[model samples]
Target: MWRLKTHMLVHTNEFNYSCGYCPYRSRSRSSLQIHERTHTGDRPYQCVQCHATFSSASNLASHRRSHLPPVFSCDVCQRGFKFKQSLL
Candidate 1:
């Protein structure tokens, strides 16, 4: 989901950032670094409340919000969410 849209258009050779695990490769170093997190049990972002960890800061933030009561809910499914964007 994190892979760039441009990656679909560009070839692997053009984007030399290859993954050590599989055939997965990315053009940006940040993309590669984030991808590598899947193989390495490295979770820099940690939730202070539960001590749960996440590879990305955004994911960590999302998990942190889960601990809180829902501020927003989906009109169709009535699913509650803490963030307004989560509803969208």
Candidate 2:
């Protein structure tokens, strides 16, 4: 039973297959199938704020930060950032 459970967990965690031309990882077979679009340069998500497109949701989230005001500013140069931790 322990061996069977371990094997199942291994299968569940595996995302060993990857696209040869791009960096993308998917644990599920379906997700891997979807991720193959990157190699083809297919971006399905488009930003409503600026019409920018991204290959993945995480990239879209990061891109959205560009539309917002900086949360932190440089004390000496007056440079700003959307993230407070960027100050450090």
Candidate 3:
């Protein structure tokens, strides 16, 4: 199964792909593929408000927060952020 293969890869410490510019390593080929985009200046995610781009979906999600209202407010200062998870 896919889970077994993924676990095997973790145990093997196989880093078949490496970053050319830096010493970044990854166990999965997909992670290496996405990391390579960073060196190549390939940003697939775009922000509509500022027309900014990011290489990963997680980055894009974080960027989108600026456009939306803050979900969590500081207890003392009342400072707001779009993500409640960031409060931790």
Candidate 4:
């Protein structure tokens, strides 16, 4: 007698990666790593100018732009921006 191998279908939305420290779950490994930073208070990304740290790289980049002088100024709100596209 031979045994047949079968596969079961699982929903993609299922929470596979769960946080060991807290009540959190993520579908992907990368998302779990970012979520874990909240509980662990880990800042892998750091700013060069101010020595400030952030959990995400994008947040650190946005913070660095603040130190630069604004080239484009808004006429209505009087908000200064480094890039012109932001005004639009």
Candidate 5:
């Protein structure tokens, strides 16, 4: 599968794409495009809950979690957590 081939590039450190502005290289075309945003100052992904913006969708996804209410709570300390694993 293509996913397996992409995962193999991580172990082999073999990337097919190179950045024109820097020494950065990536196995996927999408990753290279995201990296290029760092040089271009292009933050296409914006948070709907806030004014914050990110160059990549993954970064925006991580930021969006901060706006979410905790789904799990610690029984002993009454601490809140967004994920069940975090409560553990």
Candidate 6:
């Protein structure tokens, strides 16, 4: 219903949300806000365990993984890896 209508905007090239700082346009308001951060240099999402900050929550989440224990370990070098693909 409502969700499908929003998704269909991509096919129609109807990016109504325009950035005030740049020529970038987004289908959603949240996406536009994230893009605006590039112009403002606003890094509000801070890591609790570190001084690292990011403009977006997703970036902060990925950074948070550094504080976690590695899930996989290399058999040859005995080195640790957070992602299984990294081990291979």
lDDT of 1 by residue, 1-88 (tens): 4456566646545776899998998777888898899999788988999999899988987798789989888989999878898776
The digit string of per-residue lDDT tens for model 4 on 1-88 reads 1122111213445777899889898766777898899889999998888899998887888888888999799999999898788999
Each prediction's whole-model lDDT (CA):
0.84, 0.77, 0.86, 0.81, 0.90, 0.91
Q: Which one wins by TM-score: 1 or 3?
A: 3
Order of quality (lDDT) = 6, 5, 3, 1, 4, 2
**Over 4 Å off in model 3, which ranges?**
20-23, 84-88
- List per-candidate RMSD values in Å: 5.6, 5.9, 2.6, 8.9, 2.5, 2.2
In candidate 2, clashing pairs total 0
Segments of candidate 4 deviating more than 4 angstroms = 1-11, 82-88
Alpha carbon lDDT of residue 34, candidate 1? 85
Error of 6 at 29 (Å): 0.7
Selected candidate, larger TM-score, 2 vs 5: 5
Candidate 4 overall lDDT versus native: 0.81
Residue 36's lDDT in candidate 4: 91
Candidate 3: worst 10 consecutive residues by lDDT? Answer: 10-19
Alpha carbon deviation, residue 2, candidate 5 (Å): 3.1
- Which one wins by TM-score: 4 or 6? 6
Where's the lowest-lDDT run of ten residues in candidate 4?
A: 1-10
Greater lDDT among 1 and 5 belongs to: 5
lDDT of 2 by residue, 22-52 (tens): 6776555546655786568788888999899
